[model samples]
Target: MPGPVSNDQFFARVGELLEENKKAGHGSVFFTQKRLTPSNVQNAEDKDPLWDVNLPGPFAVLIRATNGKSKENRDDKIKVSTVVQPESSEEFFKQYADVCKAGMQALKPKDRSKRKKKKAKKRKGPVDGEKKP
Candidate 1:
């Protein structure tokens, strides 16, 4: 028996699965969390999914877990966003990647020199001692 799958392996497998499903014309498939809602809390069988995915629709399906549980698992950070739900996994990933890219950009240091140059250009009014009417 194998030990445990690393995060790299899990993410790689997820990519492969998405590609396979797309190539097979099964529409988009996404791996996302299914948070327990108040209505589902009382259902004994409606326990939070360890792993869940939706294919081409809002209906979610569970993926069997191999690692059982981990001490490093981030359950709290897995809250599903109720804001917008993409129709397909491809759409979901596209939106997710775009947000991640934007976040990365935000973390980058800004160039004050560039901003100053832009401001200088904007400050140029009428040029060569010409007055604005």
Candidate 2:
């Protein structure tokens, strides 16, 4: 049997890959891990459960690419997101790699960072240099 993959190892691998892609001008990428709670089972006697069940944390990697005349421009932008669920460490790593590859291919730089900016609030009066009315 193969040894289990540690959380640290898994997260490290994800971080390394994400950084590599980001530095290659592949836009922006983020990685996050989430803990999943397993469903509780009830007995026929209607008594309290004997044991507590919970699932290990699942890691997620997101890659985003954008393109346009400039960062502020939103004329074009495309995105691709994927989730991988593996029962074991080996499976998880394999799935993660696959998802990352797929995500990279799906990236459309033209529309990656184009987002509408929020309107700025106007100040009632100038605090510095100018006198307040």
TM-score of each: 0.24, 0.24
Residue 16 in candidate 1, Cα distance off native in Å: 0.6
TM-score, predicted candidate 2 vs. hidden true structure: 0.24
The regions of model 2 sitting more than 4 angstroms off are: 1-4, 27-122, 125-133
Give me the candidate number with maximum TM-score: 2
lDDT of 1 by residue, 53-95 (tens): 4312454322222222236753412211222233444554565
lDDT tens digits, residue span 1-133, model 2 = 2232444454455555555555666555555444333334333344435333332345333222222224664443322223333445466666667656654654565653334222121242334326634
Q: Per-candidate RMSD vs. true structure?
A: 15.8, 14.5
Clashing residue pairs in candidate 2 (N, C-alpha, C atoms within 3 angstroms)? 65-112, 66-109, 66-112, 67-109, 67-110, 67-111, 67-112, 76-111, 77-111
